[model samples]
Target: MNLIKQYVKEYKNTYIQSVLLAVLGVVSGLAAYIVLAKMIVGLIGKNTEFGFYLQYGLMVLAAMVLKEIFAAASTSISHQATFYSLKKIRQEISKKLFRMPLGNVMNISSGKLKNIIVDQVDSMETILAHIIPEMTANIIGPILLLIYMFILDWRLAIVSLIPLVIGMFCMKSVMASYGKKYQQSVEINQKMNNAVVEYIGGIEVIKMFNQSETSYQKYSEAVHENAAFYYHWMKETMIGVSAYRKISPMSLLTILPLGVYFYLNGSLTIVTFITIIVLSFGTVENILTATNYMDDLSRIGTITKEIGLILDAPDLEHGKENVSLSGSDIELKNVDFSYSEDKKVLEGVSLTIGENQVTAFVGPSGGGKSTITKLIAGFWNADAGEVIIGGKNIKEIPLEQLSETISYVSQDNYLFDMSVRENIRIGKPSASDKEVEEMAKLSGCDEFIRGLSAGYDTIVGEGGGHLSGGEKQRISIARAMLKNAPIVILDEATSYMDT
Candidate 1:
């Protein structure tokens, strides 16, 4: 709950307004119960006045109307605040991702990241929009009613509290293992999501190699595990949950019998007895409604922890001051790097490529060829030693400035679901259409692109799925060429294209 508040402090005034409205709503509802009690007491006393009936009847109607209006207004205001807070949280996550090292970002599963950002963050809407004001009203309304009952007759008030205490005990028993169970569910959900994403993303390969059976088996297994976990968890907790639901709202169990005995003994009046019964039920109703949100409240910690994993991650070390470069030459001195601790991709490696000279590292597969290029591209920071470009350590250069000075095209380049022209324009967002076509011509993609149905206006589809591998490679080349950076590193950038 504190985690949610930290992100929503900017909207405190709006939330307060909502809470005030919610309180008014609860008071209106309680006012209706009071009016009912008055009418019932009047009838019991044989007051046959039509005006008395009409006046109390009208008051009850007015109370109901106000309750609905205040509730609707409060809900609308709360939803607005919740949406704005969610937007702010997502924006912060985006900024954090941009600041983090590409390697760190990649280390996290894409499926898990998506789940946290899209699903887990979205789940907070219930707590923010409904629980905040509603819970406040639920607690306040019941507490106020209980106080009134005490003033009327303290014995009945204590009797009304019996069910609440027992209900809480049952609820506590259910919640004992809730956190662990919910965490397990989250892990299983992530695994299922990952399997589904992988299956969809690799459908082409699966079909071509006739591996559908095995791939489907994995996907189905993950889904089954997710379902089975929830089923067993619910089965285990059903007894306690059922007990709470049945016992919590049954305040009448004690109130009715006790009120009868007190009234029969002449210690309590009929009017007080009936009024306490009515108000006790109302109090129990409010308390039960409030407790209904316990499940959502309990999961706040898990959800926040998932989101914090990304927001709290350590970012790559880089200087903000832009340094002047001596030249365009690149050098790696005593550099050591590894994707994992067990296997060193590059160890104490030194190399230099002079400015205005074409250079390439010839090596077998898995020999850190792409890794070296990526280090120069600032995709990952070296575990040890320094990578220098233009006689300055890369870390000394601002990430944005370093990016602007280098154009890197990897073998597996991704294109957004946008037009081919717009895809190339990503290299230089402000590039003119003519300049884009010029780069396409220079990269030998112009002829083929023009042959397509919509020419350069054609949508590339996700990751250029609409085009062949070779075509996508040429378009990527055009995109990088459009940047016209001083340093260009092509790590098998043309692997798909013919020589």
Candidate 2:
């Protein structure tokens, strides 16, 4: 339901068209089948409808032809709708990640977030395009067919329905119990993602501290847990599928015997009985199709909840009027902050930073220096008091405008997996190649970058793996410098460099 609501919001303009096309396609396909049944039964019967058979045959053929075309059109429209919806949904999620407070986004790691951004969003397209529409078509096609069968013969209608009922019960049991195991699977996957990211990011540290064994153990355990959860889920699913296969067949076999009994007792006609038997195959399929939709509902619901939690996270501060702080000094007055409500990191601590001056935050670890820096940079809001710039409260200033005033260089500089030139271009997007090279030189990155074989055209590895820590830092500083901001707040930017 969450996925559906979000999907509707994302593609509201196309919602009606997609739904209408699906309904039209399903109805036309079923109508084509009905027309054929009527035309065939009409001929060589007590009605003796052979005279108009050719005309009706042509009509049926046209309807059949229309069904194919309409189904294709509907499927195509549905694909487009799903594509657009997923695209917008991913963008919305990215926007939320940008605004969400620290705790919200940090609850999941970069690797998991990467998977969610890339793979999970794509998973929704499968749910929407194939699973959702096919499930709907499967259901609508079966119900209409059953209605037609009932109109022909009620007794066989009842006979054809038994296995469907039982299969549905199987579906309910299978899906309801699935939530626990699937949730476990997700947890294990998240843990594995975190472990892999941590291990890879600190490979040097692991070697330095002789912690490879410990990290490997953690990695193996997380991966093993994920594998075990998937194995369990598959084992359970196999059981259900085997049972469904075993029981769903009973429809045809049971329908024949019971239908014969009804016929022997003069309760049913031969033509009606044959038609019901022919359509009994459709019953088991309808149940299966409904179950498939249930499957999509389950997966989509999980991801939707995850995304919703992120979007609904509490903001650091309620955003207000847009104002730009141009080349202004920063002041923190009577500010207090706490990660936990009860314990304060900064209690009534105040500081001032002059514009264009290199101010260093020097204190022992956990002395709130980093916290103060983050607060001044507006990554977090103070619990009390104000961070003012250019005589305006930081919260009152539009983030982009405040951002325009200050250049930040944080530890663990993240570089996009693009060319060295392209990564630097993020700060001053309009910079010419010559300007980029000049900026790189100013930051001392030009020498190393030019030494690389690919130089500016090189595709950096993920998270800038191609560069060493010093190289990445210089590049980051150069990028920030290219912005030409009046103020720069660098938190632990030189930490990677030995003091």
Candidate 3:
């Protein structure tokens, strides 16, 4: 909720106006109901002629239509608010993920984080779009209904409300039981999302190892759990609906008869008894339905809180003054780092990369060599000591300028589903077709690219699946070459070549 609050603060005025308009629209709509009832009573009393009534009825109909128009306008306004908030949120999360320390980001699932930033924001459309306006109507409509009910027969109005109160109490009990389910379900969804992403990522390995059965079971289990949760959720929803349906209609049945019995004994009038009968349904059902609306609200609250956990996390702190790294020379002094507080991966290890020269880190595996490169790129911050580059601390450098200063090409070269030339453009997005080709040749991809039917324009499969190890490596190097930064860090850059 704090994340949402911060994200939406800029759009608060527009949101307030939309909600106000919605409230007015709902008021106008409920007015039509109350007016129609009064008009009917006038006819029943023979106080107004049919012609006069018809004219007034038409005016009420027109007003109701206008109310609906206001409602539509309110909806459009709310949609804009929701869409803008979502857009800002996605952008913010993207920036935050980019800015956050790489070591910290690595501890969480990328798929789950992706879901939080993208899918979760989209899901919140329900809260900002429908829930707010409906809740306003529900709360306001009931208060008005109760006020009118009081004017009719205070005693019976109070008496007949027992069923509604009972229904509410029962609902509260059910809510208490299931409230935790919302959070539980969210966790399961994140896990399932992570599994699916992992499955897709390692599909090549799975096939190579003949692990079809194992892969299938993983996929099936995630799907099955999601389905089971939904099934139970739907069952619970039905029970709530059924319980209300069973309980609320009886408010009228209970109230009207008792009111009539009073009228028959001369304590009430026929008109008052009739009014109670006609008006009883909305009083009970509207509020009862309002309770359903609350349940939706509670569920949305859960989602917002889940989303909050990520967006509200302490951002990778940056000094107010921008830091600059002047030379390609790299130095880590007494730099200690860890993903967790106690489990340090690089413990007081210091290293240096001489300017404009390749500094290869060789170790069997898991020796924290790649971690060193990540730290150089400001993808992460050292828990202790500074990462000095060109005699300037890298931490003081502005992120955009840092990219202009350093490039890291990891072993697993990543390529977009784009033309051979386009993949190299990431190093310098504005590079011309000629510059891209030149860089590709320099990185040793020119031969393979020229042999392709489409050459530089050939579309690689996702992650460059169409390209072999050496080709992918060259393209990655081409990207680095295009970057032309003063510092280049490579992690297993030539590890899996076909040689």
Candidate 4:
């Protein structure tokens, strides 16, 4: 709720204006009810003057029109503010992810992050754009109507509220364990999402290893678990929910019976009785409309809290200074690092590579060869020692400057879904088309790229899925070659390339 408040504050002017318009709309609706009641009273009293009836009829029509116009305007303004706020929230999350530690980013599965960014963020739109202004209008309108009813006849007004109290009790019972149930639903949904993503992403692997049936079983089990959780939760709450729905709309039962009793006792006038009945219906209707959004409102707090966690995640410490590098000489001084508390990847490691020298670290798998390169590339800070580049501790260099000083091509380089030219240009965004082609030629990919249907402009599918393994590797190499950084670290970069 606080996170929602903060975002609403960002667009306070629009939010305020929308709420004011909604209030105006509700007022218009109440005015229409009043006009209708006046017309009905006149008709019942045998005052069938054509002009009087026509005048009241015109007023009711005008009030109804104004109500619709104001309601539409409020909805339009609220949607604009809601979408813009969501956009800002998404952008903040994206920037936060960029600054966070790579390890932290990797720890969260892609499907879960997608759920937060796409599904969860999108869910807030309905609550923010529609529920906020509309629900406020619904609640306030009923209160105003109830106050007018009390002024008409306080005794009957209290009678009219009996159903509302009962409805509220039912609602409270329904929501007693709503938070826990909703939390369970969210957890189960995320598990299903993760399993679905993993299943689809590993479909090829499953087929190759003849484990498709087992993988499918896992995915189907997750799906069933999610469905069963929701079914049971809804089953548990159905009784209370049904009671609320039945009770909230039954205002007329109390109003009609009590109003007749008062009229029979000579304590209530026909006009006042009619007015109370008309207005009571509107009050109950407004309350019912408001209660319709309770589920959305309840979930708002949970969704925003999840998004806030991402936005408030801690970022790795970085320096702002961009120092000049004398040369590409790299050094590690008694460095120690561990990916986790229980496992040490590198310990008391000290080494130096001279400028213009070719050095290879030959070791068994898991011997920290990749870790050493990542440290030099500033992917992660060493836990116990400093990694020096050109006489300056790597941590002291600004990220942008450090990136410009190194070109790291890993064994599994990812390619964007774009034309070859555009993908290559990512290495040097300002490079001309000619410069990109030259780099592609240098990386031995230009000949194959030229033979494609659109040549350099050919659309490479996601992760270069349309290209062969060797071709994708060459394109990645071309991109890295375009960077032209002072130091190039190739971690099995040519593994996919042909002999």
RMSD of 3: 2.8
Candidate 1 lDDT for residue 37:
91
> Residues 1-499, candidate 4, lDDT per residue (tens digit)?
8778888988899998999999899889888999899999998999969999899999999999999999999999999999998898899889888767777788888777988899889999988898889999999998999898999999989988899889889889777677667767777888899999999989879999999999999999999998898888888889889998898778789989888999999999999999998898888888888889888877876797778768777776667878877899999999999999999999999999999888898999999999999889887888899899999998888888888999888888788898999999999999999999999999999999999999999999888888988898888888889999889998877789977
Model 3: which residue pairs collide? 323-396, 323-397, 327-390
Worst 10 residues of 3 by lDDT: 316-325
lDDT of model 2 at position 53: 77
Query: Cα RMSDs of all predictions?
Result: 1.9, 3.4, 2.8, 1.9
Clash count per candidate: 0, 0, 3, 0
TM-score of each: 0.95, 0.88, 0.90, 0.95
* lDDT (C-alpha, whole model) for all candidates: 0.90, 0.75, 0.77, 0.88
Candidate 1 stretches with Cα past 4 Å from truth are none
lDDT of 1 at 211: 99
RMSD, candidate 2, Å: 3.4
Instruction: Provide the lDDT at 438 for model 2.
Output: 98
Model 1 gets an lDDT of: 0.90
